[model samples]
Target chain A: MTLSLDLSHRFQGFTLEAAFTAPPGVTALFGRSGSGKTTLVNAVAGLLRPDRLRLSVAGEVLADTTAGIWQPAHRRRIGYVFQDARLFPHLTVRQNLLYGRWFAPKSPEAAQDFDRIVALLGIGGLLQRRPGALSGGERQRVALGRAILSQPRILLMDEPLAALDEARKAEILPYLEQLRDELGLPILYVSHSMAEVARLATTVVLLEAGRVTAAGPVAVMLAQPEHAQSLGLREAGAVLQGQIAAQEEDGLTRISTEAGPLWLPRVAGEPGRPLRLRILAQDVMLALQAPQGLSALNHFESVVEAVHLGDGPGAMVRLRAGDAAVLARITARSAKAMGLRPGLRLHAVLKAVSVAQENIGRGA
Target chain B: MTLSLRVSAVATVVSLPLGIAVALALARGRFPGRQLLNGLVHLPLILPPVVTGYLLLLTFGRKGWVGQWLDQWFGLVFAFRWTGAALAAAIMAFPLMVRAIRLAIEAVDPKLEQAAATLGAGRFMVFLTVTLPLILPGILAGTILAFAKAMGEFGATITFVSNIPGQTQTLPSAIYAYMQVPGGDAQAARLVLVAIVIAMAALLLSEWISRAVARRIAGT
Candidate 1:
């Protein structure tokens, strides 16, 4: 299924004009705060009326301002999981989960399997409790269940984990991944964290100041040197699709990537399980020649594809390793000294310990 | 006492839906005539009770426009009847009821309502399931206040419906009637004590009900 949206709205200080079509899977709207991610999602949910909008999900027209057809939110059948879990304070968790069913369209396909949803969210224990009593993660789980029980045509999540603490986020991320994998539901996930986008998104639509700067598959988008600037210099990175090749006897796991075999601290997974690794540009170093006696475990022979110089002393160099892309941030002085240019071959070195466990996820 | 209770109860019950409607509108609506509607709802509180009664007399009295239609068609007369006392009391207590309910409604977070809508609930369903349940404390407080105001309403009741024993004579009117006769002081004093007792009981009952409902809604 595909979800397409084209909308333009002028606020007091900001104007949003964004259009993108997302294929099935998690399409993340990635931007900084006030970049209009939430506004775009709200317009799609029918909560906000834009000056001009045309939105449809899997061939069903949700809104068309030109035709004077603006479906009310209740009839749109689009589920929204808000940043703050807005569960009914007066109802028990079970009631809140079942609330959407009360007004849901009466059809066999619209009916959600209650037992399966509760089990999927692991909220069966919370059924007797109220929202005020649930922890943040539990509340979010209940909210997710409530939205799913509505049998929406599509799901819109607006920074669902932004309100949680690190521990709570860790507690909830696995459930989100399960939803993404098992539900087969088209999810528009909004977030500002590069780590989340790298871990969860199948596609990324980069937003900058209310405009969509770039949109493409996750691996390709994150590797673009121009797009890295908009993704924040600190978060500039490339995603590598790899598989667990072996677990060595010396407390290390080998991952086979297009670049080459990468050895990292042992990660929990069976051999041959696909994994996505986010290698931040800042964490990579370049050598003009294959260096000797290097402590770093990862060394990939690559050719420099492009050099993007920042305003400061640093420069971001994009390299192609076989079919994969890798980014390295080095001082301009070093780039000048090495005569770095497109098509120049070099070695990309990385310390295995610099790869945070938080930036790794099971890939599709 | 039975007539007083019946009149006040009917008035409180009758005006409740209108009070909630007006309160929700005042708290949530952004219409052009919002301030005018607010002022009109509150006019009875600022105007003299006698003048309010006179206005009611002009509109709902037997010979008045609405009252004439009611009398000719439905035989429902508001002038000099207990129903008129209830109507007058409802009008006088309306502002207080709306004020309490409006404050309660304003205290509710609109985001919860939006969430309900996204869950496929329509406007009225959202109000019924989310808004009304959340504001039960305010509704209880408003209803008790209106009931207490109706029980004690005398100036308007006496002016429009007059002090007719067993019909329009409420607690305050009965007390007023007893005060004008010799040796009626003891009876008037007794009624005064009853009024105080009933008012205190109503206040305590309202407090208990609201606290219970608040605790339930708050999940405390």
Candidate 2:
């Protein structure tokens, strides 16, 4: 299902005007703090009535200010998983998980299997315990289970992992990926962490100062030179979707992407399982020709698509290799000496160790 | 003592629901005249006990406006009766009831109520399933305070419903009556000791109940 929103709202000293269409899968609203990501999600969830809005999910109109059509939050059937989980403290985990089911519309299609949801969230062990007795990650898991049991048409997750420690975030991310692959539900996820965006988002909507700066498939948006400043140069990179081709000897794996085959440190997934690789711009090196004397395990022949000169001595070069895009950040002096411009052919080299294990993740 | 217990218990049980409703309005409602309603509910607490009793007598006595209609329509009477004493006690204790309950409701996070809404609960269901259980400690505290105040009510109960033996004479009224007659000092002293013990028990009971409720609700 596709979700579209054109909304405008004014808060104290800030105005949010955003419009974007999120296709099926996870559409991430990515931005720095105060970029109105939460406001946009709140508008979609009917938590905030914007000054002007026209929102629709899968062609069903949720809000239209000009037409005077507004649905209250309870009737919207859109589940929200907040950053803090918001579980009922007065209830045991099982009761909290089933709280929404009591009010769900009575219909076969709206009914979710109780045992299956509990098993899926791995919260069966926590059923008898209250929220105060659960760990932060456990609380979030129960919160997810509660929202899923509500049978929402769409799910809005506002930085659900933002409050967790690194280990806790790691613990929950796999469950999220599993949900994305199996639930068949569209998700609008909000986050400022690019690493998270690169790992989970099928589509990325970049917001800056309450405006949608760019919106497109994650792979395309990540490689655009124009988005370098908004994405924060240190975290700016390209996301390549590929499937594991084979497990090679010497603790290495080969993956095939649109660009070409890539060899990296061994990953745990079986052959044919899709993997998303996050290649940071700082990890990429550019050469006029393929170097035979280097230890880098990955190389791509590409033509420069665009050159973005930074205010400092650095520069970002956008490149197109086959059908996939790659980004390489180098010194401005090198660009001037190499006469880098659109259509100039070059080689992109990447060391195997530069791609950290954390940067590689399973894809839906 | 049995008459006093019955009067106070009846007054508290009858006013409990109304007290909760009024407390919710005071804690959450934002419409016009809220301040006026708050002041009116609290007037009996600040006013002289005799004045409050006189007002109750004027409104609910046999010859008064509501009292005349009630007697003519339903043949009910409050003037110089035990029911009238219960009414006076309830009115006298209403402020303490509302204050404790309102503070409890205010302490509850409205965000939890909003979360309940997102989970498909309407306003009434949200209150029943979320707000009520969370504010139980406050309600218990308020009810105990009101019950204690009603048990000790003397001036207002005597004014609205004259202290008739076996009918309108509550514990405090009986103590006052005994103190008035020669050689009745011993009986008055015994009743005073009983009153002190009841008051202390109510206080300790409230403290224990509130702590247990707090611990259960807090899940700690």
> Highest lDDT: which candidate?
1
Model 2's A-chain: what TM-score?
Answer: 0.93
lDDT tens digits, residue span B1-220, model 1? 9899999999999999999999999999999999999999999999989999888888899889999999999999999999999999999999999999999999999999999999999999999999999888999999999999999998888888988998889999999889999999999999999999999999999999988876776666
- Docking quality of model 1: it rates as high
Positional deviation of residue B42's Cα in model 1 after best superposition, in angstroms: 0.8
lDDT of 1 at B213: 77
Which stretches in model 2 have alpha-carbon errors above 4 Å? A107-112, A351-364
Writing each residue's lDDT as its tens digit, candidate 2 over B130-213 gives 999998989999999999999999889999998999999999999999999999999999999999999999999999998887
Candidate 1: the clashing residue pairs are: none
Write down the worst ten-residue block by lDDT for model 1 chain A: A355-364
Candidate chain B TM-scores, in order:
0.97, 0.98
What DockQ does each prediction reach against the true complex?
0.80, 0.71
Candidate maximizing DockQ? 1
Q: Alpha carbon lDDT of residue B68, candidate 1?
A: 96
